[model samples]
Target: MKINDVILRTVTKIVVFIILTLSVYLFFSGHYSPGGGFIGGLVLASAIVLMYLTSDIETVHKGMPFDFKLVAALGVLIATGTGFASVIFGKDFMTQAAMKLNLPIFGETELASVVLFEAGVAMTVIGVVVTIILSISEDE
Candidate 1:
């Protein structure tokens, strides 16, 4: 059976972009506000899920071409690395540092190590969620 899904695919493209943009905003705003790595990662995973829902796993994989397991491992490595970095510097584990730098684009921008940690967390969430979804889908 040839099912017609032109409208769904068209709308998905736009919706996915919006979701990804929102996810990025959520991630960046996390340090100062309610949103953070966990929520942002959830939102990101949702976007990926939406893509899978719109089409077959094979098709989505063609576009994304990601090994989710590796993604998860890398995320863990990154998150743990940040913590170990503190230890290497003779500080307690997971100790965070921040600094302010003046730049031509954004003046007096504050950069912190916590952002890296959050990024790791976000990547982990995305990988694990997608992997679980794929596993369940395969059961059918």
Candidate 2:
């Protein structure tokens, strides 16, 4: 690749790494704190958008490891499904509730399932947004 390519790639990689890493932290923190999934996912998508700016979609495809559409779809499905999950049990939509945890790292963690649902929404929002933006910008 050209020297410009190398530099841009490096910058994009750094940015993506930082944003994604931060996103994970923020996303997890949101479970117990104020931040939510929408912001975290948007931040994550920002990282991907940074990479998209520096490289072609073809290269991004190779590095991303999975289909963004699929991942995003899963997030949305999970979030929307959360609504159905409530009604299935005869609960109201977007109702807040506690859930059990079994993780050894954070044993007996108290998590609000609604928060998890919101986080999934965040992921899907960012994913769909980035997809649209990248596709549109590709023409230029």
Candidate 3:
């Protein structure tokens, strides 16, 4: 199926950017608010899928610049590494530490190791979803 509608292509470009931005926002806010890695990753994947639908497979692949399977593996490795990092410090597995630090622009902000864990989760989710979409698209 070829998508030749210029309006759709233009709107897709704008919407894709918005969706990607929102996904990142959700990921960051998740540490303190309601959003989280899972939801954020799903949103990001949806944006990619939208692009895939609007463009050719080759174009989508070129834009991605990374293999989905490799991404999934990296995500797992990162999450595992984060979990084991605590062990190296004589702490239990997956132990999360939080600290409040004052920055130049951002006043006092709380930082936690769990953010890394969430990032891993988000990457894993995005990789899995994209892989699934690629597989299905290829099968058709």
Candidate 4:
């Protein structure tokens, strides 16, 4: 498959950046909004796939800073660690806690431990999906 159209490549670059930004926003706003790590990760993975489709595999690899598999493993470790961390505090595994912090612009905000777990989920999802896409792309 070849994609040599300049317009398509330019559009893809703009769209990929937008999607990536939106994915991060979704991941961060997940706790209070409808979006979450799962959706965010999916969106991010899709953006990466779009990049792969618009350009060569070498470009995609260069764009990505690290290995997806390592990311997946680290995500798993983080999620598992977060769960066990609760146990260390005498709380049940996966128990969630929140704290209120006063900020300058945002005023008062509540930060939850679950956010870390969601981050792990997001990273794992991104890693798994990217790995699958790259593997398939390479086999062809």
Q: TM-score winner among the candidates?
A: 1
So what's the TM-score on candidate 1? Answer: 0.95
Candidate 1: pairs in clash: none
- Which stretches of model 1 miss by more than 4 angstroms? none
TM-score of each: 0.95, 0.77, 0.93, 0.92
**Cα lDDT, all candidates:** 0.92, 0.78, 0.90, 0.89
Candidate 3 lDDT over residue span 64-134, tens digit each: 78898888889888889999999999999999999999999999999988989888888999999999988
lDDT score, candidate 4:
0.89
Say which prediction, candidate 3 or candidate 4, comes out ahead on lDDT: 3
Off by over 4 Å in 2: 1-3, 65-73, 99-104
Indicate whether candidate 1 or candidate 4 has the larger lDDT: 1
lDDT per residue for candidate 2 within 87-108, as digits (tens), equals 8778888666887888899778
Over 4 Å off, model 3? 1-3
Residue pairs with backbone overlap in model 4: none
Off by over 4 Å in 4: 1-3
The local distance difference test score of model 1 is: 0.92
Supply the global lDDT for candidate 3: 0.90
Show the colliding residue pairs in model 2.
none
Ranking of models by lDDT:
1, 3, 4, 2
